[model samples]
Target: MEEPIRILYVINALEVGGTEGQLAELISGIEKERFSPYVCCLRTIKDKSSYSLDCPIIALGVSRLMSLQTLIGMLSLVRYLNHNRIAIVQTFFIEGTILGVVAAKLAKSVSAIVVSKRDLGFMLTKRVIWQLKLIYHFADRFLANSKNVKDYLIKKEGVNRGRIDVIYNGIDIEALEKKMQEVSGADIRSREGIPEHVSIVGICANLNRKVKRVDLFLMAAAIVCKYLKDVFFVIIGEGCLKKSLLDLSEHLKIDLKTRFVGSQVNPIPFIRMFSVGVISSDSEGFSNSIMEYMGCGVPVVATDVGGNRELVEDGVTGLLVPCGDAEKMAEAIQVFLDQPAFRKKAGEEGKKVLLERFAKNKMIRDHEFYYASLTKEKRMAFKKKRGKFSA
Candidate 1:
């Protein structure tokens, strides 16, 4: 049997964030016949013992973000990549992209390095922007989860368009469906005190008011509840804004119609129960939640910002409203509430989009093919150079 291409996935941490969760899914879904995967984390603040990973997840144990120990951690990463004979080093998010690219460049045995840009610098600091501007020059290729992120890198950061690949985020639809079956949707709705006939619109996001705009969701929900008596809103996930979001709901006098589920480890069941999946973010990269919602056969209503437009076609799979416009959002939700047949058709179409365009297997195949192609190009170039030297 031929040896599989060895690939190493590097990230800042293995916590419960978008990038970390996506990394886990990618490693699990990659074609085992063609690729052997390994994971390395700059830090492991969360419980690493809990996540079920196929490959070994090694932690470098760096305590600080930018310190002498961090430099040592990068050196250690270089040594590990060389020792493992890793054909490709793929780094995710900001810190990993910075540290991992530098380590790959410095490593003797490794040359191919890919960095994933998952966001549009929405939360970037000046120092981080400066570091990325310097470090990204050393990377071989960049992968953006959405065209929005890809364009942002080109127009804002001045990255070469040719060097960046736009690969939409994929979801494990089968796995999601299985998880949904494991938990009864009726049980969940009952626990939340949502009646079977009532329409449930939900937003599954971190309760970050500034970026995710949970407050905007509440404002929209208040508008929605006033006219649509049978509608309820659920905000899934936990963040610092939970208290303030609840307070805002009370202030708007829609507290009776709003329920904060607080961080759910398994949000798929809740998503499956949604009459409409909503994204009220001021900014986003390609949203995994939107994909999950569509996979569960739920229509989406997302803000027309970042990659939301890429995932949702207006009036097709779901609706799109202007960012921070609660009135517009409420108007969209009301359309779904008033027309059940139309909502069901949109949900079906959304599921079809997820299956055809953003399946987990498609993502793994694209990644495997891209990685193999990069390594082959590098090897062929090296061979040509050797032939020239011999002549």
Candidate 2:
């Protein structure tokens, strides 16, 4: 009998977001017999306690976005990785990706350094592109979670297309099933203060300007509510734009139709509350919220952006409108509201796709295979050279 292969997953923090959620799911679903997973966050934030993924998590308390702290953190990570006899270093996000690669390379025990590209718009700028080019060279493998990200690295940044592999993000369809089942059991209308008579349109995300484009969603919500008086827009999750969107809704005299549920630690409850889910992002990697919505059998209308088309099938699964076009977005929302049978059919199709394509167990296996492939030192060296170093 052989000891389980050790993998160290590096990310920024376990805050409540898509990245954090996926990381937890990835670890929870990994085959424990073959792979023992350890997690390390560059910044020590709170452990997201929603799911019961009891994997050991390490955090080096560091200041946010400070280079000095990041560098110190990287050094600490190397020491930790080496001490733990970690064979594979898998990093996510920019800060984690850059530091994890160098730390893995520095640790002789680490057979390969893997950098998972979780965000498509990450390092999309001309200047930071140079940095990606530099740091990417240190990696033994570039695991892209979407074709959009893989294409960006190759076409946009001139990285080797051959080196990039599209590994779709996995979701717990079973947990999603549980979410849907649990929704029916709870008296959510009374608990959340949602009016039973009002039709709920839910958007589960951070109130950010660039990515989420929640302002546009609010504008569309106003337009939709004008025609549908019994409609109510529920914006779940909070950020800087919270106050701004609240003010805008008040000024438009549709504040009554809109409610900021604030940043929810667990969005499952709120997602289950909605009759339809909406995603109005300018850009995205794979959206888990939409997946969760679909799992809950809630129809969705999302913007046509990176990896969004992958999650949603227009006229089949859920409607996808052109990004930034609030009118089309609103119209799509109306389409779902108007045709209950169409919405239900689309939601059903989404569930089928979710079960077949985005299974959490499949995701864990893909990553395990990826980790095993990295064990070959020769392959790791080739990957490191082909990916190119930024600086």
Candidate 3:
């Protein structure tokens, strides 16, 4: 039997964000018979217990990007790649992409280098863009989570369209459904002191980035409060902007109606309680939050930016509003709040779409095919080069 091809996934951290969650799911679900998976985190793992993976995880303990530690980490990565004869090096986030791509190139043994693009370059600066462009040619492939992101790469970064592949993010429907079955929304609400009769409008997003535009979610909640007094707003996830966002909620006079529940390991219960789930991001690659919402059979109100339009079928599965328009978002949310039948129908449609289009099995299969094809191409080219040398 042929040995499993070894693949290394490099990322900044193994925390509870969209990228980290997707990486965890992918590595966990990937068929071990065909591919062996490993993870290398650029930063130290603060809580090792948070991630329960079957593969080995190596942390470089890197603190600063331009320090001796980072230099040492890069060298260690190259040594590790060569020592393991890594066939594929897949990287996530900016730091991991910059470091992993270059290190994999230096390793010489690495057959393929894949860089993942999950966002619309909303946080990228001019210098960062230049830095990324410098190493773009070194990568074998660019994996985009959404078609919108692929377009952004081709248009903004001037990447060759042929070099990019779009694979939508997937969720483990069975696992999520099982958890939803185990945890009741009423129990969660009771624990949080929320009334059973009050409608819950919730959002699950990190408060660390302004791109998420959680502030808009709050503003819209304030608007929803004027007409629906029985509505309660729930904000899931934690970040640096939590304090400021708390102040903003208070300033909007929706503080009493809002609950800022910090970073949940499993937000399925809170999601289960939501009458409507919202994504107020100024931009997104593809929304894991929207998928989670749909998996729980909850309707969504999202900004029509990035891959949101792809996930949300406007007026069918959910409503799509203009980005940065809090009033428009509030109006969409109100539509769901007023009509329970339409909301339920939309939620059902969302679940059907999610099951059909974004299953974890489909994602894993797509990746396996992509990786196997790339590895084969590399081997063929190498064999041709060896024949030339012998001749």
CA lDDT of each prediction against the hidden true structure: 0.87, 0.79, 0.93
Clashes of each: 0, 6, 0
Model 1, span 85-194: residue lDDT tens: 88788888777787888888888877588888988888888877888889888988999999999999999777899999987778888788888977897888788888
The superposed Cα distance between candidate 2 and the true structure at residue 40, in angstroms, equals: 1.8
Clashing pairs in 2: 133-390, 134-389, 134-390, 134-391, 135-390, 137-388
lDDT of 2 by residue, 37-156 (tens): 998878765645644566778887765645687778878888888888998888888777777788888986787777787666643678777787798888767778788878876877
Predicted candidate 1, C-alpha RMSD? 1.5
Look at candidate 1 and tell me the lDDT of residue 334.
88
Least well predicted 10-residue stretch by lDDT in candidate 1: 43-52
- Kindly report which residue stretches of model 2 are placed more than 4 angstroms away from their true locations once superposed: 45-53, 64-71, 122-125, 180-187, 191-193, 376-391
lDDT of 3 at 232: 95
When sorted by TM-score, best at the front, the candidate numbers are 3, 1, 2
Best by lDDT: 3
Query: Which segments of model 1 are wrong by more than 4 Å?
Result: none
